[model samples]
Target: MSAPADSSALLQTPLNALHLELGARMVPFAGYSMPVQYPEGLMAEHHHTRRSAGLFDVSHMGQLLLSGPDAAAAFESLMPVDVIGLGVNKQRYGLLLNDAGGIIDDLMFVNRGDHIYVVVNGACKHGDLAHIQARIGGRCTITPQFDRALLALQGPLAVSALQRLLPGVENLVFMTGHGFNWNGADLYVTRSGYTGEDGFEISVPAASADAFARALLAQPEVKPIGLGARNSLRLEAGLCLYGNDIDTTTTPVEAALNWAMQKVRRTGGERAGGFPGADVVLAQLDGTRPLMRKRVGLVALERVPVREHVELQSLDGAKIGEVTSGLLGPSADKPVAMGYVSPELAAAGTRVNALVRGKAVPMEVAPMPFVPNRYYRG
Candidate 1:
């Protein structure tokens, strides 16, 4: 996909100079001139991550802290997740929705005991904050942690590598985090990542980011990975990339993210139908209103790979859907994609055709996480 076409100068991450020093191929992404790849290409970086650990500079993401007694309730007014019930230090994936039931953005929220901490997508961060402030600022204190840098350490060996720097981090199973003193710098490290691997996302002071990244890279198991690898990794793991697999026009139900909604917000529950779009979302969840179409995973049956926006047609030449995200999955050794289609055609094992270059390429509705997830939930 083409980067945003605005003529404005791109922003730079705190690790921008470090990326250049490491021979990164910089490209404009989400208003930032960030590295898409490095000396090692995408494929190598990907496989290396699956086998060992990959370090990613995710400082471009927005980090915000919400404090005050009304933080949970104010935040809960936005999405349907049980924010008030979210346990301390436990993070949950959530969606921001419009009143019309369309998704505004997806984010990770953690109940930090004393406050609520959230990480949102880079491109939508400013608007997301503005919306939150306009709606809930009177109740909660919203502070953007721009002075902090975010980093991801992911793969099968991620725990071992991280434990070397900060012991007891391995004790933080998936979806949990807490403040720690690492090399004398305060760090909030979460045992969670986008790659579907057993990994961690660490938030540190921007001034200490470069040095910390260097320290991690010095480990034999960790190597610097760029956005090119990052995209492929998350796609293979069946994770959605905001604006691609999901957007303002897509609802959480249509996007197959219904699991993100908690029981407390469902029918006959304590907080039922209180969040934005709750009426629409609950109708779909309770089968009061069936969804017309649902997002599904697709795997090309042939060696030829397909790209996004390619029309999916029935065998008789009727369009059913369009590919939202597609790529030659390195782990699958085949083209994998995800898109929305009629409810009947959303089942796994269903057959469809993708129109590529005016010809139809056969595909199957396969299960997601084209690569198996290895999260350490235990």
Candidate 2:
């Protein structure tokens, strides 16, 4: 395992040199040096991704393995998702909860036979590991896979570009995963990703990451994307970012992630719903009391991009909501955003006003996926 750095000065991934060579404007994000945008700027990068293909280096994320005689039992002791029932190679999106039922973080768990492979947010990696460690109670082993690099190939042309190199990867359906060899490097490829487009996330050894990324970019349709475009792309796709979209202050029900919870977990024995904060989480499951509606898509009428925590109000002056993630939608040619609001105002088409730079900006509650998701859901 690679130990975390002692200082906060920006860490670099294996692809750091590749990004600099492309003339990307490097920015510090989640304690790592990352490209915020390229010579094309954020707007162009955003548009290019929607129309073509974009490659992203997400190696800053933490990858880990949990395996032992009691791996499944130990896993169920922490997260709200069902680990025992997860079929091999299937991926499940779930949340890590505090004892009070508030989400500590959201993560993806993949069953890799005897052990489970986990990927967590980069910013919360250390805390997440500590949380899992303290609760496992000698039932399982927690091994951090710092030697791996994660890459996301997203957008309409993603399948074509990746298939051109890997040959036959286009057969993977969404949320399913498999192991493959690419240019002498082993990869764990998943037909799923953060951006709401047809894509794959490939996990490879850190040493081979840069070369693999360069190979993918060598294709005509693929371009190197930066964090700036990645943020806008996910927002447009209606995906949530940890820390901003959700955190320890919110529940899955409020975040509209109730579907991620298994039915058995909701009704099984005392131990079934026995994870931390089960009372609050299960209560939200039983009835819709004290709902904290997660914001979906919002269309800003003004040119300025609405940012986080901006107050939202009704046309008649009644306070309505606040923005969580808002920005210009280069694809829609308008500004878009998302925020929490009273349930009554959470319905689609509800008219609202965003306090943008102190002036009222007309906006509306629109259906999410600001653009339709092109995921290969088969």
Candidate 3:
């Protein structure tokens, strides 16, 4: 999460009042007054979501629609992902890149047949909108749906709770979505989320968000989750948080996100090299350019919580890297972190030290998803 801005100037989501009513400890995040945790506390919320369903008010995220015959091709030019090849109703995680191959922001886009729907980070929305408009607005009609409220119903039992409210939602496998009607409100729901769990992200009308959230909370398996648990959950899932783990300075290849780029966008494919920084990204992918550092997962041998910005050093005390995100993963029952390290030291089982208050805390590079991802593919 970004640093707390001026609380007085923070924007309020449609569920703000409901959050207050539920005794949430509000904090300023991404320019919004968001719930950090409710009366049940962060640990409870975290465990609850892991065991059942957790509802998150992600309405702060920017939602947009790009229409016209050129929408797909136009969007494809902004990122390495194969937007043109995306089938209708399919959703894909994407990175918006700059000319130098650094990530501008990470986003999710869905093929809506007539229009391409895009959702961007809350903190980067304004700039993202401007960037897309300036780059592809002439090729496609860009419509920003900032008024929409987005809710993520996530966990092992997420589908059970949501399907009860909106029948047929269970039919949406991971990475797919469809439009639905809920109590006279139109909703576009995708069976996807940041928490690496089988979940659904519902785009509901802002006006009806309160009632919708309350209804979901009424379900025995569903509970309100806050940003605190959301962060830990994503960290445990090995998912990168936009500003924390990725930013304008991080390239997709160096960030270990090569899988997000399809073959069509790689060097030998038909539609390769049209995106911003395509040369740089593709070179890193094909090994024509050497990477200085690589993102890797780390698990502390001790129980100490290693946090972001903590310096990581080699066994011999040579500075090797810095932690980008870390915590005592509630689910993993151990302290885990992700950071960039010298390429030679990025392999799993490589031992390192996280300097906490000048003490060397031993940590070993490990495979990610500190907790195994439970995405429903069937």
> What's the lDDT for all of these models?
0.90, 0.85, 0.94
Clashes of 1: 0
Task: Compute each candidate's TM-score over C-alphas.
Answer: 0.97, 0.93, 0.99
How accurate locally is residue 229 in candidate 2, as Cα lDDT from 0 to 100? 89
The stretch of ten residues in a row with the least summed lDDT in candidate 2 is: 1-10
Q: Across residues 261-286, which tens digit of lDDT does each residue of candidate 3 receive?
A: 98888867669888999888888998
TM-score-better candidate, 1 vs 3: 3
TM-score-wise, the better of 1 and 2 is 1
Candidate numbers sorted by lDDT from highest down: 3, 1, 2
Error of 1 at 244 (Å): 0.5
Alpha-carbon deviation at 26 in model 2, angstroms = 0.6
- Give the lowest summed-lDDT range of ten residues in model 1: 1-10
Model 1 TM-score relative to the real fold? 0.97
- List, in order, the clash count of every candidate structure: 0, 2, 0
